[model samples]
Target: MSINAKSADHSPIDEDAEQLARLGYTYEKQFKREMSFWGNVSLGFTYLSPVVGVYTLFASSLGLGGPPMIWSFLIVGVGQFFVALVFGEIVSNYPVAGGIYPWARRLWGRKWGWMTGWVYLIALLTTIAGVAYGAGTFLDALVGAEASTASTIVCAIVMILLATGINLGGTKLLNKVAMLGLIAELSGALVVGIWLLVVARQHDLSVLFNSFGAGGGSNYFIAFAAAALIGIYQYYGFEACGDVAEEVPNPGIRIPKAMRMTIYIGGFAATFVCLSLILAVPDYAAVISGQDTDPVGTVLSGAFGAVGYRVVLGIVLISFVSCVMSLQAAASRLSYSMARDRMLPASKLLAHFQEKRHVPPYSLLLACVVPILVILGSIVSPDALVVIVSFAALGIYLGFQLVVLAALRARLKGWKPSGAFQLGKWGVPVNIAALTWGVLGITNMVWPRTPDSPWFVNYLVLLSAVAVVGVGLIYLFAKKPYTHSDAPAADAVPPSGSNRSVAENAQSHHVENYL
Candidate 1:
């Protein structure tokens, strides 16, 4: 357990650090190692905040595919669960600060790892803008604001600034509010779900499969897939558990459990709220046809009245604020982790942890500033934000699945899966499933289907993604930033055609190298 940190050989942080050292890199003694078990779990849960996830996109999902989108949640949730299992195995064995970068470097190599962190960090920032923007909608509804583009953007800025302040207060403040946010989320889900289910079950249970002819084109599946994006967005953030892997206690055991629990709890909450609101949607046709004022808003107002609905929105607001706080923390940690490896500009400054604050000061600042700027531009052309978020989802999935792919490659070539939690015989199959699911998910998300308009606008997501990567590559090669020596033994190629025991590899390797 990496609790309040101890010696380089004793405490959980030491345990985690020892694992880091064996991976050909030294652990930087910076963070306070102060997050508790619940605090760490809250880290993932809040990042994947079900209230924020479900409520943010609830109306859109209903409009796109009606009630059947719930099935999309189930599919993505299950597929994402398989991915989470792979992550659990990784975190159990590695348990380091820079979640994907270190894991990928160990499984693949430095270049792959750098690309993984680069994509994932930017994705996180894009999502921060999306989530903060989402919060603005609910806040606007609660406050009876005009809900204009300007008002919504301002509301988002307010929430972002508030969350930024809380994040800057450091993890201690983050943890306390995160737990409270979890409570608010759980209670809100329960109260909202049960009340709507009991008092407002207007539709039959079978409506879950009803597309209601909302499918946009000739292909019904196309519309269903489009709506699935909502759930797809909800499920990916659970991997934040691995992102902040080093800060928690008993991370070998705790981190994996926290990861799984995030899916279990977040999944249940998201689906429950989704189901409750769907059944209570009153007139599905009206909602899908834009005749109703949004099924989610309708259900909340019907069940609790306007005042009571605003009360619920208040809880959802907490969930949103808390979600932003957690996302910022996770994003900063990723930045710090990558910067620690000297992969980014101003690596020294970005990687410097504020010892007194127990935070990555510069990383935290960047985390806030970039998103704020993006949000500002989003205010200008909301479509720009949409392209950013669409690609963010794609980028995150690609980064995460790349690690899974690397692990699968290693597993096939004599790398044994060993951790406090091991998949054993199930490892190969699970890894394969994760990769398959990832490819499908990424394809669906990044596919260029904007209907009408020019090729550039239609393929904006894919185009933007390729452009960013292209630019990043140019920057990478131009700067030649990866010049630092990376603990030389790390890249030592094994003897040609030599067959080494998994046990032997595990030993020289950091898996058993730490032990």
Candidate 2:
């Protein structure tokens, strides 16, 4: 039996365990000592991928080149940081695997939490598909292979399966693999970026700063706004660290620190890469015009020749694949956490962890299978990846907004968590600011692009809206909320008496696992 399941005979199954049984599952604390702070941070940071840097090419294509693109990235990065802080404060205090879902419930109430959880869950799943599909596209570019919808779909499935296999090996293995991949990704990006900057040192850096009117045809603000949508996406996925807070030791301290590191490091790295790619462009028009294939690769091929181009392509592929793996790890933990809470159907199966592996085998399997199908099925339309990614972003934005608002309200009502991290006096204003920015981003993303808009990319405002509503409805009627004491096998002891946060207890069993 897993170390956690073995613990069942020694101690009384807590109220939480009882609740888990209602959903047809048994809670197993299977993942412990599996990830360090840096490893967890790396998982979240890798998701940005080349997607953020490549976003600049699209920005340029839409006519919002020059200073505007750089400024847009800066603006989005800072704005998103506020949201991260809100997450950090709560996650550190709770450090539970349910993450946004449990935080929402604690701060708001059961009904709102249930609704928000579904949206967060679906968004996370779709985000996995979007990142995996992008990995396939980058791999295709590296191999000089033509990627049709069918080919991309098949590649996505293959990549997802590989990622799942890695995760099934347990969090320790997953963290090690993720750390290695992260180093390669960052190292490769830096090598190319620095090399390009050094070679182009004599070029007029001012030219890179000059703003070009949206291709001379679209609205300047709207163009910049569109670029901001792309820019803002780069700053996300930092919260993935919190979803597996239970697996990390000293989670109250480590989880918050890890989250802060991800936000600051990821934000700076994304901005640096975006700027470096733009400055490396010998001819912006040529780079922007080649979106039919790989715009970033086109620029690299011209600027550094075939070898340099191939190297960049290879790095992009590796980074994207790493991102897919990281997403699977996070998504599976989220599903497992929710299932253990009796909030999802088939909870027993979905939440089960293997004793010898100390891994959520079923959850990992589900996470991998769902994304492959999503990537394959969604590849038929033009700009399928962009639409899906944006659609996924909307869900994340909503979840973040809700959590921030909930936290603010809870604090105002005198709810103070005695924990390792607390915002003190700055919490309310920061949360308010975060909420404003989130609302603006959602509205801007949903706003349609006009024929005269600088960014010509199609928006999936309607589809994204439909998805959020659909998820909310499903939660309203189908998902059931459970009391902490409802589960049969869990120690239902309150956090105060147990000296363990819900997340720590849920994930503490893996520490003794080596088999």
What TM-score does candidate 1 reach?
0.91
lDDT per model, in order?
0.77, 0.67
The reply for model 1, stretches above 4 Å from the true place, is 1-14, 24-28, 485-515
lDDT of 2 by residue, 1-515 (tens): 22234354543223224323332343455455568878888887776554434543444433444445667667888788888878877775556676787678656666666666777887778887877675656667667888777777777788788888888888788888878877887787677778767774324557545554443565566666766665766777778888877667666566767777777777766666766766765555543344333445655776678777777777776677788787777778777777776667787899787887787899888888777666765746546555556667788788888887787776665555444566667778888888899888888767776656545344465576576778677656664454432432212223343454343344333221010
For residues 413-508, write the lDDT of model 1, one tens digit per residue.
666655667777888899999999999998887666566779888777788789777777887778765565362221222334756532234334
Tally clashes: model 1: 4
How well does candidate 1 score on lDDT at residue 268? 89
Worst lDDT run of 10 residues, candidate 2, spans: 506-515
Q: Count the backbone clashes (under 3 Å) in each candidate.
A: 4, 20
